[model samples]
Target: MPQNKKFGTFAGVFTPSVLTILGVIMYMRLGWVVGNAGLIGAIVIIIIAHVIAVTTGLSVSSVATDKKIGAGGIYYVLSRSMGIPIGGSIGIALFVGTAFSIALYLIGFAESFNAYLGFGTTISDLRLTGTIALSALTILALISTSVALKTQFIILAAIGISLISICFGSTEFVPTTVHFFSTENAVPLEVVFAVFFPAVTGFTAGIAMSGDLENPKRSIPRGTLYAIGVGLLVYLFLAVFMAYTIDAEVLKTDYNILMKIALFAPAVVAGIWGATLSSALGGILGGPRILQAMSMDKVTPTFFSKGKGQNNEPVNALFLAFVIAEVGILIGELDIIARVVSMFYLTAYGFINISFFLESWANPDFQPKFKVKRWIGLIGFIACFTIMFKLDMIAMIAALAIISAMYFGLQRKEVKLQSNDVWKSVWENVVNKGLKRIDAQVEENSNWNPNIILFSGKSDHQKYLLELCKTVSGRTGIVTNFKLILDKENSKPPLKKIDQIVRDEQFKDLGIFARQIKVDNIYNGIKNIASTFGFSGVEPNTIMMGWPKGIENSEEYSKMTQALIHLDYNLLYLDFDRVSKFGNYSSVDFWWRETDSKNAEMMLNIARFIIASPRWNDTNIRVLFVNNNNVDVSIIETKISKLVEDLRVNVNIKIINNAVEQKTFYTIIEEESIATNLTIVGIPDFNPEKQAEFVLKTNSLFESIGSTLLVKAAQNFNELDLDLLNK
Candidate 1:
């Protein structure tokens, strides 16, 4: 929130321009392609690159103006407009691409150094130069990222001075070259696009500075488009200069092609060398913010998102990016690096274009202020896809393979609960799709049912739960109600000198009754509370109750109060894990009697409810939708399809049509309990009082039998609404 925690107008424009310079410099390596294609091909490439940059920038800025953007800004747009999963994929792709670009930039750094030092005569010296540059870059990255963006002002200024020198000094070095007498081809047209595609990209790098910009919408569009146009002009000027001044044959075989031009005019070498260094450092300092955003959104681990140093920079991810780039620098395969980086950005941009169209189709309410006429969005999509196909297919496939793995891997943790109606679907997804960290504590108690106990020593505890119960029950219109027992008789120590203590211990018990009806007798009041909390105009089934923690003699009371409270109040003990640890729920095992169990659909839904809790996240889930298997395959498939389609948890289906699969299924449950950290078993038995005892025993085993839970799926689910589940 400090005002100075942002980039100035010049700095904003400078960052993306640096990235653009880094990208465009690749044409030097691909000069033969430009030389072969003649001026027309060069013109076409420049025009297409500009159009892509302008249209994409406009599309991005259009969204930026309407929303308060963050460093993780683009994903917010993608998630809100499309959905979180696809947004997550784009987040990963963008980060990986930017990180890899640092490597490509470093390779350029080493080559520039080799050319200036004239060390390419020996292979070992070339490797040493690459090593020295990469090490220096790694250290520089750590320093620049350690401070706030304000400290980078001096660095940016130096870069500007250097660029000016390169422009002015190079004019005197222009050498006359004879025109070609015959036409000849070297690299194919497809190969030229493949190599130069990454070089002409990265205008969107400015968007990562959104968190540091005063008016990102206005600034990002102007800065991004201007940087692209200016970078094109710069590239064109340098390309023309190098073409006329340097020998084409020498440039083709030379690693330090730019340095040769700088050498021809001694005054320009220092300026161009400094310009290349500034371009590398500028990218190093800015790109990791996007990675930090990606990590915060769960595309990567949480470590990258944590604030570091007094400035709260995303230091971990920044350093990680540099380290990855260094490894890439050591390999120094320009073709492989270029191909990978292109595939990364193109894949992400392709989605950006699709989300534009999907937003119009699925969410008509999202209207961009600066619309890229629908056809332009379509054109952008085609251009991105076409470029993607022409790039290295092997690289594209490899990038996608990694992305898809992370996509589903991360999706398991992002599931949220809806209404009680979806509880079964939720449960199924968690068991089937969630991430499971191996923990002995949870594994031991996997079969044990932890009671769903709500607490109310403080008035807020009961109030929040009561409101939630009403919300859940109202939506499902099912009989999901809870019991309230106020312990007014609990001893309160006498205060000294007749001092009064302000507290509301008894208010907890009487709070539910205060809503509409008052019960004079606490015993009969339990039933009345149940009816009131239960779905109105519907038969009562489940009553939710809060467990008192941090109070003495509460455990005994928790056990004794269940029978009096209502055999229906299934006690659920909530686990509130840290936000960083939040993820998928592991193991949703349903107990089904042949007649009543087909509601395995309902049971899968219950697991999703468990996942919404912070405690169960980042845990793997096992879904048991049991069928006695006497039912037809078509019916089972219908139920299974619905469960998979609707629920978002990791699921495994078990069909116990006979005693054989049933025995195997039960054994599987034991094995699952040992393997996973948590287990959920639906209350298959029907005796309310006996079920209450089962719930109590299950809660007692929280420490010994494995971290297990028992939910009366049928009892409480009837009252939950479908819409208010996540809230």
Candidate 2:
């Protein structure tokens, strides 16, 4: 049997969030924000900051409805969507911000308390009393969260009474001139916003109590958004009242303006302290819960995971929180803590939006009852990050560095329970974007990125052949390890083997997939998948294969090549040997055949790709031509320059003017490519009967020239108005 839930929205979320929103800042610094920013600028700052919070609230609501929202609230949602490392980092940061905020709010309570008691608002006086208040709140929070939250009900009543009295204190409508913008107080609006933004961020106070909630998924969204709405209304009323009734200079200097102008001044003073003390209590309670959640997640050390007291209270976490709060007290300034806290909170908010955005975009299972436009998350991300940079660059960088360090550290540890996240969604979208860019400009020569489909009989046996194709494909294109099983049924073909090859650790950076197809004939299976290969934005543009074993097998190879080439697939035939020879890679020998630059375009480009890889790092890419002197050297140089210059890669050009026969051609291959591991050659036009024999002899002749890749340009077929390719 389970214990019943003991709290609802009003007590659990709204009271805490509203108290914190109307905390030290509203009582002490909203006047300063208004003074520096003026009436219009103050309203602008409030709206912009709240818009980000409200948008994040909406995103939170959207994500909460999609799944069984867990104990960590914002951290849970972020982890479930974006992955643990990132969510855990932000969760810890949020905990620190919450802990530090306890000190900030206590200091506010002490300052206002000292003034009410007829003592001047001195730093030393506030620090002494603030430490005492911190001690009291830590005891109350550790007593039980329920008891602490119950006390917030009383604080809420005091704040409400104070608000009512404040309205009654000023209905004169003196109509002080409200400037659109101002720096009359010698304070920048960005600085003023940094002071005020922390107010609305307290809406997450309820979310941090997610572990203790009855129906967290339902309660969290309701509580947080309600807090934001109520806070907005109260601040709007105060802003308008202050703008119409009080003079700008007076508003600027008065830290206790609410107490000074309220109908019942003493009651307002109690309300200010009540608001401050409640916010400190809320932070004290929430901060520990966040820590406990992180510890349970195993992102932090597990020592903080224990909840020893009755009703499973976070005693150990609360002790740590108290220790941190004491350290915050040593800093002895509310405004400094306020600014730093704002940075962490804003960073958390940015990730919240990012998590939601990724959840919606990546996961098809992510169907929330409450839907928002995708742009809302995007806007929230921009707003939070923008305001953070505007407030303080150093603080923002420091916060990000801390989060990044935590993310990497957790990632390094490799937690045992791996939950699915939007990592696939992120990479899939990246691959999709590249495909879309390629698809959109199919007409342009330069826009093409290779998508090679290899007709590998048992590709895993010679994985390096596919790797060479992958390196040539370079991260931009897709590489499929295809196996043709000779049967009608499409049964499995050692899927673990296929998966191993597809996820080859060495070539993980490239786009790779695996498939095993069964057909009566190899050509039909190759043709069928190739015709329908890939999703939108990507399709097979090239076909690669190892040179067949026998002279009798040449007909099938030629047919496969022609059929795919007819589909506009650029074809390459690899005559393999070893990848490394001569003790370090040498050069790529590219046989530049036609002057149209169209025929040898892909060959030249592939040679460039080969030499660029880590395996062939600094290997020279020389453009070799069997020149009969028909094409001028200057014409060839100009064309090569135009092509290679745009590529921003290096290459060398060589002319072989010897009237080359097949005998001399094989000699030229051996001599010119002696230091090279790979030679790139274009398949010349020849009779079908004789071509196979010619290729077999050519392969044998260049066997010592290392591995040779024979190329034929399919793009030239489309350029030549070939009708078979269009089909």
Candidate 3:
């Protein structure tokens, strides 16, 4: 528990890692792997396994150099890089995997010990021995991590002596020829690789000690890589030695072949015992730290974050890990536990690689002192999962499904972490690059989309107007809502910030970019702002506002509308009906006129946008053309039908052939669209001198309609086409 008792590279990282790497699998399973896969095939498996391991180690190293590592080791690194949601999922999996690993190592130790008793041992006997071992190791880990790690040194010595004995030991029986490939009846190479993989996974034992290290960034990379290199050499040497020293049949049948091949048989026995116990101890020490880290991050219950004594040892978390390991021991099958543990570890390792890949690729500020090629992390990620499915597809699927469920569950919690900023930066980079590409292209009428700027006044006071603008823009276009404040006092920094926050809160879920703008005059301010509102590629091409309440500012509104038109901005004025508020959202009427074809086309586009929303998805549209000309009614109907067909919208066309003297245009609109939920009308062109008269006449035109959208096109548009609507 003492703070000054932290470990350096040798005792902290290299010792635990090498001892674990050389543990139970190397002693108990290497001969079986060599027998099933033969010398050359075994070497290939070793290389493939180490390729994944070395790359993952490199990724870990690179990330460690960039971030200051805390108690949870890989959990801390992943959560800090990828955000808490993903990090918590992998962290929980890694904790359980480490706990299961304890049971695996203990079972290995018990199997070896029971076989040494020279009795007919049953599964019950192995379980009993494992349970006892688990108890002893739990007690040792509970005392202190420093004590448990220090014990690994003695275990390391025993493994070193056993390996030396194997190299020099004499064997009476020998094969006539060395088997370079798998023997008949041998299991598949992937199956053999899965069993052998745990041998090299011990490198993380050092990484798990990140919080207890004197200097984690320096010790972790140096010690982990060194341990991997050493383990690789030892495994390769033993595979070749066993292939030449004894027959394949003997190697296949005898799990204790390492002991028999050693010059001093008892030394190999001691080594197996040391190896398994040490790896179990490593898991006992490391697993709880992961839980503790998650608890600290609020990914798990905070109670588990409580630690004991001077070093703040994760005592409560350690107990939870002990219970999980005890349950794993009750399963009482080494191979089964190994497979489950492999799946969990592979999931964690794959995400670790992904964390490094995303950090390096997305974050410009990700500068690491110990650098690795970004692709190495990517390759490692792919290889880990590939090997996982090859080992056991059902297990792989179950593991991923569990991780995914955990991720979603964590997402609902307000467990915010600074690591989530990486995604913000990623999105910014994508938007900037995309905007540059869009800027280089020429503007075309066929590519026209509504990039609207709404003079919303106050978002609370104009909720209907805000909703209409959002629905018209849909998902394909952009909507920027500006609350134009007439008072210059509101433009001060603190008040502006408060106003901005209020605007953001109001429009956060609406997907509308809301801002507050200070203006001297309402009409001039809107005219100037609408004229220069956005960037070259994604500029606001349309200006929308609610209908003026009275004729008091009719002249100012008319001048602003004229100025926006001069600046090539299409205009939309909504006259919202507070009584009906879109009246059941069932029907929409569009009044089309050939003389105002541009405004009619804009009206059609707006109607299509309205129908695209879920609230109006079932709305029926009708296009009405009052044919007062002497031209044939059938020909006008045909042209209107063709236009609707080109736009790909399902709308009924109505041709009202009546004399101009019999019914006025306003009277026809009022009678025809009275039953519809919403009506779209074209704004007539008017001179600036008669602005008040125009506003008064237009306000009286749709007095009986449920709700109306009056549209004015900036200029004549090309004929309506499929591209304009679909894009």
Local distance difference test values of all predictions, in order:
0.52, 0.76, 0.83
- As for lDDT, the candidate ahead, 1 or 3, is 3
Q: Candidate 1: minimum summed lDDT over ten consecutive residues — where?
A: 445-454
State the lDDT of candidate 3 residue by residue for 583-610, as single tens digits: 8889998887656667767776777788
- lDDT string for model 2 (221-286, tens) is 788888999899888778877877777777777777777778998778878989999988888878
Instruction: Return the candidate ranking by TM-score, descending.
Output: 3, 2, 1
Once fitted onto the true fold, the runs of candidate 1 whose alpha carbons sit more than 4 angstroms away are 1-4, 22-32, 120-127, 144-185, 237-251, 255-267, 360-362, 415-727
Which runs of model 2 end up more than 4 angstroms from their true locations?
119-121, 169-180, 183-185, 416-419, 425-447, 455-464, 483-502, 509-536, 552-568, 579-583, 594-598, 611-617, 629-650, 659-663, 715-727
Model 3 residue 216 lDDT score = 96
| Candidate 3, pairs of clashing residues | none
Residue by residue across 491-510, what tens digits does model 1's lDDT show? 54323322322223443432
Q: Estimate each model's TM-score.
A: 0.53, 0.88, 0.91
After superposition on all C-alphas, the RMSD of every candidate to the true structure, in Å, is 16.2, 4.7, 3.6
